[model samples]
Target: MDVRSSAVTIPAGNADLPADLLVPAEPVGVVLFAHGSGSSRHSPRNVAVAHALNEGGLGTVLVDLLTPDEDEVDSVTAELRFDIGLLAGRLAGIVDWLAAERPVGGAPIGLFGASTGAAAALVAAAQRPDLVHAVVSRGGRPDLAGAALGQVRAPTLLLVGDLDEEVIALNQQALGQLTAPAELRLIPGATHLFEEPGTLEQVAEAAAGWFHDHLHPQPARA
Candidate 1:
Protein backbone atom coordinates (compact mmCIF):
# COMPACT_ATOMS: atom_id res chain seq x y z
CA MET A 1 0.00 0.00 0.00
CA ASP A 2 1.34 3.43 -0.86
CA VAL A 3 -0.39 4.80 2.21
CA ARG A 4 0.65 3.71 5.70
CA SER A 5 -2.61 2.10 6.70
CA SER A 6 -3.80 0.32 9.82
CA ALA A 7 -6.86 -1.47 11.14
CA VAL A 8 -8.69 0.56 13.77
CA THR A 9 -11.58 -0.35 16.01
CA ILE A 10 -13.50 2.84 16.71
CA PRO A 11 -16.18 2.99 19.33
CA ALA A 12 -18.79 5.05 17.52
CA GLY A 13 -19.83 7.81 19.91
CA ASN A 14 -19.08 5.52 22.87
CA ALA A 15 -21.44 2.97 21.36
CA ASP A 16 -20.27 -0.63 20.92
CA LEU A 17 -19.39 -0.28 17.26
CA PRO A 18 -16.26 -1.55 15.57
CA ALA A 19 -14.88 0.36 12.59
CA ASP A 20 -11.91 -0.19 10.30
CA LEU A 21 -10.18 3.13 9.65
CA LEU A 22 -7.38 3.56 7.12
CA VAL A 23 -5.78 6.99 7.04
CA PRO A 24 -2.97 7.84 4.67
CA ALA A 25 0.09 9.81 5.76
CA GLU A 26 -1.16 12.93 3.98
CA PRO A 27 -4.69 12.21 3.01
CA VAL A 28 -6.65 14.26 0.49
CA GLY A 29 -9.87 13.16 2.16
CA VAL A 30 -11.64 10.24 3.84
CA VAL A 31 -14.12 7.88 2.18
CA LEU A 32 -16.39 6.18 4.69
CA PHE A 33 -17.54 2.81 3.36
CA ALA A 34 -21.11 1.64 3.85
CA HIS A 35 -20.98 -1.95 2.66
CA GLY A 36 -23.88 -4.16 1.72
CA SER A 37 -25.60 -5.59 4.78
CA GLY A 38 -24.38 -9.13 4.09
CA SER A 39 -20.86 -7.82 3.76
CA SER A 40 -18.53 -6.16 6.26
CA ARG A 41 -15.12 -4.61 6.48
CA HIS A 42 -13.57 -7.80 5.17
CA SER A 43 -15.26 -7.50 1.76
CA PRO A 44 -12.56 -8.15 -0.83
CA ARG A 45 -14.12 -5.89 -3.45
CA ASN A 46 -14.41 -2.93 -1.14
CA VAL A 47 -10.92 -3.58 0.19
CA ALA A 48 -9.57 -3.46 -3.33
CA VAL A 49 -11.23 -0.09 -3.95
CA ALA A 50 -10.06 1.22 -0.60
CA HIS A 51 -6.51 0.28 -1.43
CA ALA A 52 -6.80 2.10 -4.73
CA LEU A 53 -8.14 5.22 -3.00
CA ASN A 54 -5.35 5.06 -0.45
CA GLU A 55 -2.78 4.88 -3.21
CA GLY A 56 -4.37 8.00 -4.65
CA GLY A 57 -3.88 9.82 -1.31
CA LEU A 58 -7.31 9.30 0.24
CA GLY A 59 -8.23 7.71 3.56
CA THR A 60 -10.98 5.12 4.06
CA VAL A 61 -13.23 3.83 6.81
CA LEU A 62 -14.73 0.39 6.21
CA VAL A 63 -17.41 -0.18 8.81
CA ASP A 64 -20.16 -2.65 9.49
CA LEU A 65 -23.54 -0.95 9.60
CA LEU A 66 -24.78 -3.78 11.76
CA THR A 67 -23.34 -5.16 14.99
CA PRO A 68 -22.24 -8.78 15.24
CA ASP A 69 -25.47 -9.64 17.02
CA GLU A 70 -27.52 -7.75 14.47
CA ASP A 71 -25.68 -9.46 11.65
CA GLU A 72 -26.42 -12.85 13.14
CA VAL A 73 -30.09 -12.04 13.42
CA ASP A 74 -30.28 -10.59 9.92
CA SER A 75 -28.54 -13.64 8.48
CA VAL A 76 -31.72 -15.53 9.22
CA THR A 77 -34.42 -12.86 9.30
CA ALA A 78 -33.09 -10.97 6.27
CA GLU A 79 -34.59 -7.81 7.73
CA LEU A 80 -31.81 -5.61 9.07
CA ARG A 81 -29.82 -6.12 5.90
CA PHE A 82 -32.34 -3.98 4.05
CA ASP A 83 -33.10 -1.63 6.90
CA ILE A 84 -31.84 1.58 5.34
CA GLY A 85 -32.94 3.70 8.30
CA LEU A 86 -31.15 1.57 10.86
CA LEU A 87 -28.03 1.33 8.74
CA ALA A 88 -28.07 5.06 8.10
CA GLY A 89 -28.27 5.71 11.81
CA ARG A 90 -25.19 3.59 12.38
CA LEU A 91 -23.40 5.37 9.54
CA ALA A 92 -24.24 8.75 11.09
CA GLY A 93 -22.91 7.60 14.42
CA ILE A 94 -19.55 6.85 12.82
CA VAL A 95 -19.41 10.25 11.14
CA ASP A 96 -20.06 11.82 14.52
CA TRP A 97 -17.25 9.78 16.02
CA LEU A 98 -14.87 10.83 13.23
CA ALA A 99 -15.64 14.46 13.83
CA ALA A 100 -14.37 13.99 17.35
CA GLU A 101 -11.52 11.60 16.50
CA ARG A 102 -9.82 13.73 13.82
CA PRO A 103 -7.33 10.91 13.31
CA VAL A 104 -6.63 12.11 9.80
CA GLY A 105 -6.48 15.81 10.68
CA GLY A 106 -10.02 16.92 9.80
CA ALA A 107 -10.16 16.06 6.14
CA PRO A 108 -13.34 16.35 4.05
CA ILE A 109 -15.39 13.16 4.06
CA GLY A 110 -16.94 11.19 1.20
CA LEU A 111 -19.10 8.07 1.30
CA PHE A 112 -18.79 4.91 -0.80
CA GLY A 113 -21.51 2.30 -0.75
CA ALA A 114 -22.51 -0.93 -2.48
CA SER A 115 -25.80 -2.80 -2.94
CA THR A 116 -28.45 -1.84 -0.42
CA GLY A 117 -25.84 -0.05 1.61
CA ALA A 118 -25.87 2.67 -1.01
CA ALA A 119 -29.33 3.65 0.07
CA ALA A 120 -28.19 4.04 3.65
CA ALA A 121 -25.20 6.09 2.55
CA LEU A 122 -27.46 8.48 0.68
CA VAL A 123 -29.81 8.82 3.62
CA ALA A 124 -26.93 9.47 5.98
CA ALA A 125 -25.42 12.02 3.62
CA ALA A 126 -28.76 13.72 3.27
CA GLN A 127 -29.06 13.93 7.01
CA ARG A 128 -25.57 15.36 7.39
CA PRO A 129 -25.31 17.58 4.36
CA ASP A 130 -22.59 19.80 5.78
CA LEU A 131 -20.29 17.00 6.88
CA VAL A 132 -20.33 14.79 3.78
CA HIS A 133 -18.75 16.14 0.62
CA ALA A 134 -19.63 13.52 -1.99
CA VAL A 135 -21.04 10.03 -2.60
CA VAL A 136 -20.36 7.04 -4.91
CA SER A 137 -22.34 3.84 -5.26
CA ARG A 138 -21.48 0.52 -6.93
CA GLY A 139 -24.15 -1.85 -8.22
CA GLY A 140 -26.32 -0.09 -5.70
CA ARG A 141 -29.97 0.12 -4.77
CA PRO A 142 -30.16 3.83 -4.21
CA ASP A 143 -33.89 3.75 -4.89
CA LEU A 144 -34.35 2.30 -1.43
CA ALA A 145 -33.39 5.66 0.02
CA GLY A 146 -36.90 6.90 -0.81
CA ALA A 147 -37.80 10.54 -0.22
CA ALA A 148 -34.43 11.39 1.26
CA LEU A 149 -33.02 11.43 -2.25
CA GLY A 150 -34.60 14.81 -2.87
CA GLN A 151 -32.85 16.22 0.18
CA VAL A 152 -29.30 15.17 -0.68
CA ARG A 153 -26.94 18.07 -1.24
CA ALA A 154 -23.73 16.23 -1.95
CA PRO A 155 -22.95 15.30 -5.54
CA THR A 156 -23.73 11.64 -6.15
CA LEU A 157 -22.40 9.11 -8.66
CA LEU A 158 -24.27 5.91 -9.31
CA LEU A 159 -22.52 3.05 -11.10
CA VAL A 160 -24.47 0.14 -12.47
CA GLY A 161 -23.65 -2.87 -14.60
CA ASP A 162 -24.71 -2.79 -18.21
CA LEU A 163 -26.15 -6.28 -18.07
CA ASP A 164 -28.05 -5.60 -14.85
CA GLU A 165 -31.01 -4.04 -16.62
CA GLU A 166 -33.35 -3.88 -13.65
CA VAL A 167 -30.73 -2.26 -11.45
CA ILE A 168 -29.85 0.18 -14.21
CA ALA A 169 -33.45 1.24 -14.47
CA LEU A 170 -33.72 1.66 -10.74
CA ASN A 171 -30.59 3.78 -10.68
CA GLN A 172 -31.90 5.89 -13.54
CA GLN A 173 -35.03 6.59 -11.55
CA ALA A 174 -33.07 7.39 -8.41
CA LEU A 175 -30.76 9.63 -10.38
CA GLY A 176 -33.75 11.72 -11.40
CA GLN A 177 -35.00 12.10 -7.82
CA LEU A 178 -31.82 13.86 -6.79
CA THR A 179 -32.00 17.63 -6.25
CA ALA A 180 -28.22 17.84 -6.12
CA PRO A 181 -25.62 17.09 -8.74
CA ALA A 182 -25.73 13.45 -9.85
CA GLU A 183 -24.88 11.06 -12.67
CA LEU A 184 -25.65 7.44 -13.51
CA ARG A 185 -22.93 5.46 -15.24
CA LEU A 186 -22.97 1.99 -16.74
CA ILE A 187 -20.01 -0.41 -16.65
CA PRO A 188 -20.11 -2.21 -19.98
CA GLY A 189 -20.75 -5.95 -20.06
CA ALA A 190 -20.51 -6.37 -16.28
CA THR A 191 -23.01 -8.19 -14.11
CA HIS A 192 -24.47 -7.24 -10.76
CA LEU A 193 -21.27 -8.37 -9.01
CA PHE A 194 -19.00 -6.63 -11.53
CA GLU A 195 -16.86 -9.78 -11.87
CA GLU A 196 -16.03 -9.15 -15.48
CA PRO A 197 -12.44 -8.65 -16.52
CA GLY A 198 -11.18 -5.26 -15.28
CA THR A 199 -14.69 -4.06 -14.50
CA LEU A 200 -14.07 -3.51 -10.80
CA GLU A 201 -10.96 -1.56 -11.74
CA GLN A 202 -13.14 0.76 -13.81
CA VAL A 203 -15.43 1.31 -10.85
CA ALA A 204 -12.47 2.06 -8.60
CA GLU A 205 -11.02 4.56 -11.04
CA ALA A 206 -14.32 6.37 -11.48
CA ALA A 207 -14.87 6.57 -7.73
CA ALA A 208 -11.32 7.83 -7.20
CA GLY A 209 -11.82 10.55 -9.79
CA TRP A 210 -15.14 11.64 -8.32
CA PHE A 211 -13.83 11.82 -4.77
CA HIS A 212 -10.64 13.53 -5.90
CA ASP A 213 -12.52 16.10 -7.91
CA HIS A 214 -14.90 16.95 -5.07
CA LEU A 215 -13.20 16.13 -1.79
CA HIS A 216 -9.55 16.46 -2.82
CA PRO A 217 -8.86 18.77 -5.69
CA GLN A 218 -5.35 18.58 -7.03
CA PRO A 219 -3.25 21.57 -8.07
CA ALA A 220 -3.10 22.52 -11.71
CA ARG A 221 -0.66 20.35 -13.61
CA ALA A 222 2.81 21.84 -14.00
Candidate 2:
Protein backbone atom coordinates (compact mmCIF):
# COMPACT_ATOMS: atom_id res chain seq x y z
CA MET A 1 0.00 0.00 0.00
CA ASP A 2 1.14 3.51 -0.70
CA VAL A 3 1.10 5.40 2.58
CA ARG A 4 1.40 9.14 3.10
CA SER A 5 2.29 10.65 6.44
CA SER A 6 1.58 14.19 7.60
CA ALA A 7 1.33 16.27 10.74
CA VAL A 8 -1.55 18.43 11.79
CA THR A 9 -2.37 20.58 14.78
CA ILE A 10 -6.02 19.87 15.50
CA PRO A 11 -8.13 22.40 17.35
CA ALA A 12 -9.31 21.03 20.69
CA GLY A 13 -11.28 23.44 22.79
CA ASN A 14 -8.78 26.16 23.68
CA ALA A 15 -5.70 24.14 22.66
CA ASP A 16 -4.24 22.52 19.57
CA LEU A 17 -2.91 18.96 19.67
CA PRO A 18 -0.17 17.82 17.31
CA ALA A 19 -1.28 14.69 15.48
CA ASP A 20 0.45 12.31 13.09
CA LEU A 21 -1.84 11.17 10.32
CA LEU A 22 -1.02 8.16 8.16
CA VAL A 23 -3.28 7.53 5.20
CA PRO A 24 -2.99 4.53 2.90
CA ALA A 25 -3.51 4.85 -0.83
CA GLU A 26 -6.32 2.34 -0.61
CA PRO A 27 -7.52 2.42 2.93
CA VAL A 28 -9.46 -0.54 4.31
CA GLY A 29 -10.34 1.53 7.36
CA VAL A 30 -8.89 3.98 9.83
CA VAL A 31 -7.62 3.57 13.37
CA LEU A 32 -7.00 6.21 15.99
CA PHE A 33 -4.41 5.41 18.62
CA ALA A 34 -4.97 6.66 22.12
CA HIS A 35 -1.66 6.54 23.97
CA GLY A 36 -1.43 5.37 27.55
CA SER A 37 -0.76 7.28 30.72
CA GLY A 38 2.40 9.39 30.53
CA SER A 39 2.79 8.37 26.90
CA SER A 40 2.42 10.52 23.81
CA ARG A 41 2.21 10.24 20.04
CA HIS A 42 5.98 9.68 20.27
CA SER A 43 5.60 6.31 21.96
CA PRO A 44 7.60 3.72 20.01
CA ARG A 45 5.20 0.89 20.76
CA ASN A 46 2.19 2.78 19.46
CA VAL A 47 4.20 3.84 16.43
CA ALA A 48 5.17 0.23 15.78
CA VAL A 49 1.57 -0.88 15.94
CA ALA A 50 0.50 1.98 13.69
CA HIS A 51 3.11 0.96 11.12
CA ALA A 52 1.88 -2.59 11.21
CA LEU A 53 -1.67 -1.43 10.70
CA ASN A 54 -0.62 0.78 7.81
CA GLU A 55 0.97 -2.26 6.20
CA GLY A 56 -2.42 -3.91 6.55
CA GLY A 57 -3.91 -1.02 4.54
CA LEU A 58 -5.44 0.89 7.44
CA GLY A 59 -4.98 4.61 7.89
CA THR A 60 -3.93 5.67 11.38
CA VAL A 61 -4.10 8.85 13.39
CA LEU A 62 -1.99 9.19 16.50
CA VAL A 63 -2.83 12.36 18.39
CA ASP A 64 -1.42 13.85 21.52
CA LEU A 65 -4.27 14.07 24.00
CA LEU A 66 -2.59 17.03 25.65
CA THR A 67 -0.81 20.04 24.28
CA PRO A 68 2.78 20.68 25.46
CA ASP A 69 1.65 23.03 28.24
CA GLU A 70 -1.10 20.71 29.38
CA ASP A 71 1.27 17.75 29.38
CA GLU A 72 3.71 19.71 31.48
CA VAL A 73 1.02 20.30 34.05
CA ASP A 74 -0.15 16.69 33.84
CA SER A 75 3.37 15.50 34.60
CA VAL A 76 3.09 17.06 38.02
CA THR A 77 -0.66 16.84 38.73
CA ALA A 78 -1.40 13.49 37.03
CA GLU A 79 -4.86 14.95 36.70
CA LEU A 80 -5.33 14.90 32.92
CA ARG A 81 -4.31 11.29 32.33
CA PHE A 82 -6.80 9.86 34.82
CA ASP A 83 -9.73 12.02 33.83
CA ILE A 84 -11.50 9.62 31.44
CA GLY A 85 -14.31 12.04 30.63
CA LEU A 86 -11.94 14.77 29.50
CA LEU A 87 -9.73 12.41 27.53
CA ALA A 88 -12.74 10.78 25.90
CA GLY A 89 -14.09 14.14 24.87
CA ARG A 90 -10.82 14.97 23.19
CA LEU A 91 -10.80 11.65 21.34
CA ALA A 92 -14.39 12.24 20.27
CA GLY A 93 -13.54 15.68 18.99
CA ILE A 94 -10.73 14.27 16.87
CA VAL A 95 -12.97 11.58 15.45
CA ASP A 96 -15.62 14.14 14.60
CA TRP A 97 -13.07 16.24 12.77
CA LEU A 98 -11.76 13.27 10.81
CA ALA A 99 -15.25 12.15 9.82
CA ALA A 100 -15.83 15.47 8.13
CA GLU A 101 -12.36 15.84 6.60
CA ARG A 102 -11.43 12.33 5.44
CA PRO A 103 -12.75 10.19 2.60
CA VAL A 104 -13.36 7.04 4.59
CA GLY A 105 -15.75 5.26 2.15
CA GLY A 106 -17.88 4.05 5.04
CA ALA A 107 -14.99 1.90 6.13
CA PRO A 108 -14.71 0.76 9.70
CA ILE A 109 -13.05 3.06 12.20
CA GLY A 110 -11.53 1.67 15.38
CA LEU A 111 -9.75 2.75 18.53
CA PHE A 112 -6.37 1.27 19.45
CA GLY A 113 -5.27 2.15 22.93
CA ALA A 114 -2.71 1.29 25.56
CA SER A 115 -2.91 1.49 29.41
CA THR A 116 -5.11 4.27 30.72
CA GLY A 117 -5.82 5.42 27.21
CA ALA A 118 -7.85 2.26 26.82
CA ALA A 119 -10.36 3.67 29.24
CA ALA A 120 -10.60 6.82 27.20
CA ALA A 121 -11.02 4.80 24.03
CA LEU A 122 -13.85 2.83 25.55
CA VAL A 123 -15.57 5.97 26.66
CA ALA A 124 -15.18 7.52 23.22
CA ALA A 125 -16.45 4.43 21.48
CA ALA A 126 -19.45 4.41 23.74
CA GLN A 127 -20.22 8.01 23.00
CA ARG A 128 -19.92 7.59 19.23
CA PRO A 129 -21.24 4.17 18.37
CA ASP A 130 -22.22 5.23 14.87
CA LEU A 131 -18.66 6.25 13.99
CA VAL A 132 -16.46 3.77 15.86
CA HIS A 133 -16.48 0.22 14.49
CA ALA A 134 -14.09 -1.58 16.83
CA VAL A 135 -11.87 -1.18 19.89
CA VAL A 136 -8.58 -2.78 21.03
CA SER A 137 -6.52 -2.36 24.14
CA ARG A 138 -3.07 -3.57 25.21
CA GLY A 139 -2.07 -3.80 28.85
CA GLY A 140 -5.07 -1.54 29.48
CA ARG A 141 -6.62 -0.26 32.65
CA PRO A 142 -10.21 -0.73 31.53
CA ASP A 143 -11.43 -0.82 35.09
CA LEU A 144 -10.56 2.81 35.38
CA ALA A 145 -13.23 3.54 32.78
CA GLY A 146 -15.87 2.86 35.47
CA ALA A 147 -19.48 2.95 34.21
CA ALA A 148 -18.41 3.86 30.72
CA LEU A 149 -17.48 0.21 30.21
CA GLY A 150 -21.14 -0.79 30.02
CA GLN A 151 -21.92 1.68 27.26
CA VAL A 152 -19.45 0.36 24.70
CA ARG A 153 -21.13 -1.21 21.66
CA ALA A 154 -18.23 -1.93 19.34
CA PRO A 155 -16.51 -5.27 19.02
CA THR A 156 -13.70 -5.01 21.60
CA LEU A 157 -10.45 -6.89 21.86
CA LEU A 158 -8.19 -6.89 24.90
CA LEU A 159 -4.58 -8.07 24.62
CA VAL A 160 -2.43 -8.59 27.68
CA GLY A 161 0.90 -10.14 28.65
CA ASP A 162 0.53 -13.55 30.24
CA LEU A 163 2.79 -12.80 33.17
CA ASP A 164 1.03 -9.52 33.88
CA GLU A 165 -1.37 -11.25 36.22
CA GLU A 166 -2.96 -8.18 37.71
CA VAL A 167 -3.81 -6.61 34.37
CA ILE A 168 -5.14 -9.88 33.00
CA ALA A 169 -7.47 -10.05 35.97
CA LEU A 170 -8.56 -6.49 35.44
CA ASN A 171 -9.26 -7.14 31.76
CA GLN A 172 -11.25 -10.20 32.61
CA GLN A 173 -13.32 -8.21 35.06
CA ALA A 174 -13.90 -5.47 32.53
CA LEU A 175 -14.69 -7.98 29.79
CA GLY A 176 -17.46 -9.40 31.95
CA GLN A 177 -19.02 -6.00 32.31
CA LEU A 178 -18.86 -5.03 28.65
CA THR A 179 -22.07 -5.28 26.61
CA ALA A 180 -20.32 -5.67 23.28
CA PRO A 181 -18.79 -8.72 21.66
CA ALA A 182 -15.39 -8.92 23.33
CA GLU A 183 -12.43 -11.28 23.60
CA LEU A 184 -9.25 -11.35 25.66
CA ARG A 185 -5.92 -12.64 24.37
CA LEU A 186 -2.98 -13.44 26.60
CA ILE A 187 0.49 -13.39 25.06
CA PRO A 188 2.68 -15.76 27.01
CA GLY A 189 6.11 -14.87 28.41
CA ALA A 190 5.44 -11.23 27.63
CA THR A 191 5.49 -8.39 30.13
CA HIS A 192 3.42 -5.23 30.15
CA LEU A 193 5.48 -3.65 27.38
CA PHE A 194 5.75 -6.89 25.40
CA GLU A 195 9.48 -6.10 25.29
CA GLU A 196 10.53 -9.72 25.06
CA PRO A 197 11.87 -10.56 21.60
CA GLY A 198 9.08 -11.37 19.13
CA THR A 199 6.42 -10.43 21.67
CA LEU A 200 5.68 -6.99 20.27
CA GLU A 201 5.55 -8.46 16.80
CA GLN A 202 2.95 -10.89 18.01
CA VAL A 203 1.07 -8.00 19.52
CA ALA A 204 1.21 -6.19 16.20
CA GLU A 205 0.12 -9.28 14.31
CA ALA A 206 -2.83 -9.87 16.61
CA ALA A 207 -3.85 -6.23 16.36
CA ALA A 208 -3.55 -6.23 12.59
CA GLY A 209 -5.56 -9.40 12.29
CA TRP A 210 -8.30 -8.06 14.54
CA PHE A 211 -8.51 -4.78 12.66
CA HIS A 212 -8.39 -6.49 9.28
CA ASP A 213 -11.02 -8.97 10.20
CA HIS A 214 -13.31 -6.35 11.58
CA LEU A 215 -12.51 -3.36 9.37
CA HIS A 216 -11.60 -4.60 5.87
CA PRO A 217 -13.95 -4.53 2.92
CA GLN A 218 -14.91 -7.72 1.15
CA PRO A 219 -13.24 -8.34 -2.19
CA ALA A 220 -15.30 -8.20 -5.35
CA ARG A 221 -14.75 -11.51 -7.09
CA ALA A 222 -13.41 -11.48 -10.62
Count of clashes, each model: 0, 0
**Per-prediction CA RMSD (Å):** 3.7, 3.2
Q: Write the per-residue lDDT of candidate 1 for residues 62-143, one digit (tens) a residue.
A: 8777778888998999999898988888888787777677777778889999999999999999998978889999999999
Residue 18, candidate 1: Cα error in Å is 1.8
lDDT of 2 by residue, 43-123 (tens): 999999999989988999999999898899999999998888888889988888777666445456899989999999999
lDDT of model 2, residue 85:
85
* Candidate 1: pairs in clash: none
The lDDT of model 1 is 0.88
For each candidate, the alpha-carbon lDDT, in order, equals: 0.88, 0.88
